[model samples]
Target: MVKQPAPDTTRRSEKSRRAIYDAALALVGEVGYPKTTIEGIAARAGVGKQTIYRWWSSKAEVLMEAFLDLGEQSAREAGQESYAFPDTGDLAADLKAVLRATVDELRDPRFEVPSRALAAEGVVNEQLGRELVAKLLEPSLQLYVDRLRTAQDTGEVRQDIDPRIALELFVSPLAQRWLQHTGPIDHTYTDTLVDYALYGLAPR
Candidate 1:
């Protein structure tokens, strides 16, 4: 068998990978995804295009990984161990806390521009849209799934409720607001979403 790369080589590769991710995010933000090219990413990242191709097959793949890394970084900076919804046993509070953090993230320029470009493209490109939802978005949503499941177990949520669909009640509204410019996104808004989702809209 051929010899594998040394540890130092692997570290260098990781460093290069991060640089490529940063370059891709910046380029997509500045120029939009369709205009972001492998060559441009390579130049901005100071890596060869072959290096990017060695790991990812296309610009879309690169951008997807780039966005994932950005989200993880944001979560870590916010004192979260991972980008998962919290399960503090208080369903409303946990949901509101996470959503408030998300509101801050949505307003972050580094995330907003590139994410907007991808969202715009996804609206018209079904394949890319599904891919983005499946790969970059669904995993995060699953955290809410887990939280909702716990709420169901504790009788906080209705026993017959579908956690997957139920979680979307609060989650999707914020997502739509940010994606489509439908409404404002802030802590108070998200807090109210949590309350409305749990208590219902019919004069509780």
Candidate 2:
């Protein structure tokens, strides 16, 4: 039989895990992904190097999980269910709400700083970029895909349209704006994107 950890032991582990996540995010933000070492994260987290190794095998793994954890924490702080999109039967409203939340998240220094560092590294490191896309970006994008599929089923979207491609109409614009600093990102901008994407710029 497998032994379960005691309640106090589990609490301590959770605390350590949170600390490690915070330290990993902070270190990556401060020094970029190339310089963020497990030893440095352990030192910042105030845990032994073995502590991190016991939970995560590589710095990439730790940083990935840390970013995911931060997203969940942000969602909770915003009174949202982690990893969920609103489905209030109004697709445009749902998309707008999510995009607004994303804008807020992008504006947050805690999220933006490390995210920019990782993104900069990803621009030059193809393997790491692919891994980050697979591990971090794809899952979030899938939520939009799922939502668009639901819209299609409800006749809110054209039957022949591809949900994945349709999503990019709104999503890609915001992503480009955020990544390139080409324009402002806010509720109005995203709302306009949703309106234009869903209804089209030309009259019906």
Model 1 has an lDDT value of: 0.88
Model 2, 75: alpha-carbon shift in Å? 1.2
| Winning model by lDDT | 2
Candidate 2 C-alpha lDDT tens digits along 60-177? 8888888988999998998888989999999999999999999999999999999998888999999989989998999999999999889889989889998878889998998899
Give TM-scores for every candidate, taking all chains together and pairing residue i with residue i.
Answer: 0.92, 0.93
- In candidate 1, stretches whose alpha carbon ends up further than 4 angstroms from where it belongs are 1-8
Per-candidate local distance difference test: 0.88, 0.90
Q: For residues 42-161, could you state the per-residue lDDT of candidate 1 as single tens digits?
A: 999999899877778889988998898898898788887776677789999999988888899999999999999999989999999999999888888888888888888998999988
Worst 10 residues of 2 by lDDT: 1-10
